[model samples]
Target chain A: MQLDWFTVAAQIGNFLLLLWLLKRFLYRPILAAMAARQQRVAAALTEAQAKAAAAEALQHDYLARQQEQTASRETWLTQAREEVVAQRQIWLAQARTEAEEARGRWRTELQREQQEYRRTLQREAGQRLLALVRRALHDLANAELEAQMASALLARLHALDGETRQTLAQAARDGCAILTAFPLPEPQRRTLTDGLQQFLSPELNLDFRSDPTASFGITLTTPSQRLAWTLDSYLDGFAAELQALIPPAGGDNASAYDQA
Target chain B: MTISPDQTILFEFGFVRINATLVFTWLTMALLVGSARWTTRKLSATGELSPWQNLLEVLVEGVQNQIRDIARQDPGPFLPFIATLFLFIAICNLLAVVPGYEPPTGSLSTTTALALCVFFAVPFYGIRRHGWRGFLHLYLEPTPLMLPLNLIGELARTVALAVRLYGNVMSGGLVAAILLLVTPLVFPALMHALELLTGLIQAYIFAVLATVFIAAAATAQEQTANLSQSRR
Candidate 1:
């Protein structure tokens, strides 16, 4: 086998050329691409991690806000409940006060109406009683009835105490006077004079006066002392005594009367 | 028939003779360069890759891994030289089956050129890593009295590398030719197929040896420094 130094040199040159060419074309670009891809993948991973951290922080913030809002809502609800209860209590108290006031006014109104009814009943009864008495007096009244009522004067004079008898006797030094609803008959006048002269001095002279509107009664006056009794006076006194003996109509009326 | 592609000169202008070895080498380089350019033209940094691009990436990555494994260092600096040597030799040996195609690797000149490249690359990388003095210091390893033997060993190994490749490739082609003359059919075809296996293996062996030699030279200075420090 023969060696060609020239061809060896050319082949060496070719190998070197091939080395340079392959380095430029193949190794440089492929390795660069691989390295670039690795870097890009790393960057993507890093970015994803950052985004995850941020999202987690945001979630925590949202949770905290939600909890705070819940607490605030609870506080507001509690306060509102208290206010509602307070308002209800005030309303109940006001309603109770208004009801009491209305009841008081109704009671006053009822009392006034009862009093008016009683006054109307009393006036009607009094008028009827007076009419009945007048009618009775017209039917049964005569000189005899007048003389009988006049006889009570003697008893009234006899019932007087010694002090009052002396006071009357001393006051009767002036002439005595008498009043009546009608003019007295002779017999009735003598009877009243005889009865009055027993308590007073025997020298007491009597003056008699009559008025048509006066009560059907006798009245005697001796400047300071006079006495008389008549059928009209006797009837009016009996009616007043009957009214005083009657019981009260209602408990409310008795309490009202006591209060008045 | 001529035994070597170098003897098959197509043209001559004195010593500047154009031979079949140079032509085939040029053809191999063109194929390598063109394919490299084509595949790398749209090199994608992400996503799907074209089939050719995938094939090229596998080939390049395989070379890098092989270099890294043997050298125990970063494969970046030596990747192109080591890979190109394997690709050129393998392609040349594989093409021998084609009628009238003379493989450049079957010539002594091409193998010597490759081995000489390896021989020179060892010192070049070592000197670059540890300076010329540190690299030259490897010749006196063990003792200064062993310097002549060490020099002869270095030269002998370079010759062994060239001869081993050339002998394997040329003998495969020559055996096929001789068998064609003797049996003319099936035996010669079997030998040609066997030559393909041998060719690929020789390419692998040559690349591994080159890697070992270069790695030793690159790291020898530091090893020597450590040993000296330990001894002192």
Candidate 2:
């Protein structure tokens, strides 16, 4: 076999014409459609992402607002409790003060009434006693003219034991004796000097000064000691004896005597 | 180179002698038609194709895929034309193996015709895609001064495609013939294998060049359109 030029040329011409026709009719439309579809898909994805971001932003805002609302509510509640507590304390204090004032007023009124009642009872009792006394005297005056009698009665109180008596005598004579007049009474002076000499066991020098304020009393004086037995001293001793006899309700007799 | 009595009988057609080459060309066309029909009948979206149909589909799909990648578009509409071109060239190359068959691509006339078809189709598709103005603007690509160079480049590409296939296929056949005449036994088998290789290579070159031309036409048209719009 050999190569033929004419037939090959005819065949090639046919193939080229066919290719041109196919390209014109087929490939371009399909490519355009594919490109458009890709663009649409890309746009959709972008829009979806944008929507997701917006949703996230909204969620964040809602959460922040919720937290703010909760905080404000808590503050409001705390403030309200403080105000209520203050008001309640103020009311309680006012109630307690009013109760105390009412109690004070009731006590004052009761005291005033009690004083008036006491005064009335005493006056009534005194008037009754005076009437009774006058009646008895009138009755006794006629009876006394018929008969008269006279009698004397005496009782001896036992003195304390020796130790007690000695303790009392020593306490009474312990301080220095004093003479109030410029010239002492001879008996009183001698007795004071003798007592001091005996107690000292030797002769003692004494000085005396008169004080009108130490009236009607003997005061003995020595160079280092003095003793007072004035009327003011006697009164003071009597007062002390009376104070010891009447002890305060809860105090001991010994403590009362020591105070006197 | 003595012609046999049967060869002479087959050559006499009316008063003019019809070359054995013409018969081989007819045989190639017949083979193309038969294969095309067989491949078409086996085409199914459902099960596997027979081996022959599978081979045809692989060849078609390979060319189609190449065109689609280059053209950056669907090659479905162009499949018939490209597949036919590929099959025709393949069959023409294989015809060299048949007892009295010759390769059509080895002839200058056939190669020139193929080149002319590619040349004409490039402009035709460019015009179809971007109109007549766009087709003319292919010469003026890059700049007005580039028009002559672009034209020359286009001519050169066509010539190169035609000459490349013709030279390669013709030399292979010549070598096989010379080796067969010299050592008729061992060399013929080696020549046959070499011829088979040559045939496949030339077929591949032809299909690849066709795809490149189509891609260039489409791209040029796109550029021309863009230029005109920018100018506007």
Candidate 3:
């Protein structure tokens, strides 16, 4: 085939111009839009990931705070319980000490009262015994007949029991001198001395005197000693003798003693 | 000048032709122009068509499919250029059967023009996709020492494309002409059938080469942008 150089050159120029125009107007814009869309998608995905991480962190922090609160609450409850138990123990200890002290005080007061009552009973019994002894002495002085009977007792001294006579003789031999506040004749005194001398040692001295206060009883006085055999003494002796006498064993006698 | 079967005739000023070469060139040009106009005018949004519309659609669709394979991107914008090139070459190639018509593409002048356009457009699209800086840097690839070699290689590719098309088409013509001179009856029928096959094959080769050149330019621009981003 024959080639047309002019026609071919014109056609080549047309093709070049067409490619240039399409590249300029269409391809460049499409590629730019695609790149922009890619960038937007990448940025959006990064932002979403960051927000999700932040949310997860916040959730973790919240859970940690909740756990801490629970722990703190448990601690507070434990401390409160300890305080209450300690307080209760302190109160109980105090109460026990107070009760013990109260019991001790009551025991001491009861002991003191019992000791005071025992002392009062002992003093009252001593006073009653002293009063009864004084009354018995006054009653013996009023019995005069008994004193007169005892004044005649010197004449009947020779008729005394041998044990009684020997006791008097031993008393005379020990340099004892007898003094009397009653009157006696010389012959009678001599007879009395001679009768006493038969059972007495030679160391005896006898004397006589008259006194209305003697009350018909012979009284002997020795140096630093006195012996009186008076009606009051005889009556006291007779009362003691009567009190020592036991009645015959009978139901009536025993019943009478129980009544007295 | 006088025209005879064995004598060369001069027409339209100083143009010379031995036989029907001039008539074939005019017929090829007329067919290309006519088809371009009809295809553009009858393009349907819904794709419903008459026989002529169907023929035009198939040609355009075929070119688009080839471009799609090479570019690996939308071939819509490149369809007109690739389709026009394919149709022009196909018409020129088939015109050899029209008694006195010869395909102009069988000559060095026609193929050289097409190859130079491809050479220039390849860089032009590369510069448009990247920039003038990137287009210039394509020669400096592999290493700076490879710059001269790359330039020579690009020149060789353009020369090869042009020469290969010219040689294949011209050899077909030469064979047919020689055969016609020997046995005009049985040989012309066989030669006509061979020419039809050669016409389709040459047209496809031209379109595929153009598609490959455009694809290379696009790929180079993409690589440049990737390198720049990586450096940053």
Q: Which model scores highest in DockQ?
A: 1
Which runs of model 1 end up more than 4 angstroms from their true locations? A55-260, B178-194
Residues A91-204, candidate 1: write the lDDT tens digits: 999999999977876787678668757865775687588779877885775556656667766777788899988887888786678777667798788877876776677887
Model 3, C-alpha of B43: deviation from truth (Å): 4.7
lDDT of 3 by residue, A212-237 (tens): 45543556544533445555466556
lDDT of 1 by residue, B1-232 (tens): 7789999999899889889999999998898889889889998877888888778778878988999999999998888789889989988888889888899999999999999999999999899888989888899997888899988988999999999999999999888989989999799989989999999999999998999999988877889978989999
Distance (Å) between predicted and true CA of A242, model 1? 11
Q: DockQ for all models, in order?
A: 0.57, 0.07, 0.06
Which residue pairs clash within candidate 3?
Answer: A1-B102, A1-B103, A1-B104, A2-B103, A2-B104, A3-B104, B20-B100, B24-B101
- Give lDDT: candidate 1, residue B113: 99
The structural similarity of chain B in model 2 to the true chain B, as TM-score, is: 0.83
> What TM-score, over all chains together, does every model reach?
0.66, 0.45, 0.45
Better structure of 1 and 2 per DockQ: 1
Distance (Å) between predicted and true CA of A143, model 1? 12
Candidate 2 DockQ vs. native: 0.07
Q: Tell how far residue A82 is off in model 1, in angstroms.
A: 8.7
